[model samples]
Target: MLVRVLGSAAGGGFPQWNCNCPNCDGLRRGSIRATARTQSSIAVSANGVDWLLVNASPDVLTQLRAAPALQPARAIRDSGIAAVLLMDAQIDHVTGLLMLRERSTPLPLMATPEVLSDLSDGLPLTRVLSHYCGVAPLPLALDAPQAVPGLPGVTVLALPLPSKPPPYSPFRERPRRGDNIGLLLANPQTGRRLFYAPGLGEVSDAVLATMRGCDVVLVDGTFWTEDEMIRMGLSRKAAAEMGHLPQSGAGGMIAQLDRLPSGVRKVLIHINNTNPILRDDAPERAELTAHGIEVAFDGMEIAF
Candidate 1:
């Protein structure tokens, strides 16, 4: 299994255009020891030739351009990307489908029916893309390992996680089963596994069981604390309210990660701009390092 961390920041990339918070301002002014990042997205490959994108982030163009492996080679219009698997229907996660409108062939999109419906009805990317390069929807069922159509040797297992609907969804009464999910990519050939959950609301016993004995685990690092945005004056909603579990505190992701096998490589992705972990000199960075957790960066590669 080969995994590439294309973009590691949360919805608004680090140094978000409209805000000048401490971390953003510090990075912009070269005072903070942190690199600028785009929105979160990742690409996985089994044979290193055909790739599957986990999420088509709004910054997909920039992310793809940075990864030379994803570029076209022999054919003028050929793309290495075989398909896209969406975890949710958020604008930041799916808007990049528009940038792929110029593809020579229709792109294969895999997601839950709920996510596909949100795109078709509310955001209408599915309907609008029909006029351009069309999209073929591959329904993802929870806990079922399905082989990616074009990419062999790779199998993806999705597990539903507790999450809220995207704010733009017309049916935002409450989240149903398929609103969001975690992906477990396994390589049957090598027996290696990777677990990814960038929109985790809570860590259930099932989620922990899924992580057991996994080679690598990349999880949500959206906020450092429940009141991170509130303390930063960025938003009124707590981290849990926004469908993200904080990285710190007693009932946080760190505690859960600590319970994973020591051999499991733990990484943190989808970090928010307000999180102080972006700073290299922050004490939080050292704390995570001490716990053997890596903070993901753009263009990071992990092979198992």
Candidate 2:
């Protein structure tokens, strides 16, 4: 099994275009400590030939351009993706589906029922795609492992996690409940298993034990501290409130990861722009390295 990091940044991308924040300014100044990243997305290949896109990022076209394999062989309307497995329904995660509108048939999407329901509503994906019938919703049941149609050796398992809608939305009235999820991927042909959760709220012991024997783990690296969004004025809530763990500070990622058994090989994904760790010179990066954790970058490939 081969996993590729297509886009490693969280929403708005690293150094968001309209953002005037210090990080954004630093990136523009060509500071060595700053790095630019596209929106979050990943691709998993069963035999390194056929691949499944983890999420359809807003930068899908560019990401696809970066990887020659995603381009349509005959025309852009063909379904180049074997299938798409959505980790969540966040705008940053699903906006890229628009670029696939040129595809003639509905793209097969594997996701939880709640997530499918949210997409059916006025979420960004449905709203933009409402006028067109290009994309169709295919929901996956929790706990049931589904064999990807084209990927013979790989099977994807959906693990339900607690999640809700944005607090500011009028849709908050009913609020999407239990939509968030993590993935447990396995390639029996290669005897590889990976536990992936790029937007996790809490790390449960059950999940830890469940993934104990996996070869590689890609978990959330959204913020360095709970107050990251507040400090940046991007949001009024903390990272924890948004259902993620800060990679820094007390009781944060370092501490939580400390308890994991040796040899787990943890890598952080869905990194935010404001996190100083994005800078190779930052102390946070060094700390994570010393602790045996890696920060995922675009184009980084993991094989197991």
Best by TM-score: 1
List pairs with backbone clashes in candidate 2.
Answer: none
What is the C-alpha local distance difference test score of each model? 0.91, 0.79
Give a tens-digit lDDT track for model 1, residues 1-304. 7999999999989989888999999988998899999999999998888999998998999998899898759697877899999999988899999989998778899999999989999799989989999999999988798989899888899999988768888778767889999999887878989999989989899999888868999999999999998888888999988999998999898898999999999999999999989998899999999999999999999997
TM-score quality measure for candidate 1: 0.98
The alpha-carbon lDDT assigned to residue 290 of candidate 2 equals: 95
Model 2, global lDDT? 0.79
lDDT for each residue of candidate 2 in 1-304, tens digit (9 for 90 to 100): 7888999998888888888777788888886676688998999886666789998999988888888766547653554587888887788888787777665556677776666666777475655665664555567777778887777787888887766654434355565544777888887866778888888877777766756767778988988888987977888989887788898777787777777779778899998888878888888889999999899988888887
TM-score of each: 0.98, 0.91
Best of the candidates, lDDT? 1
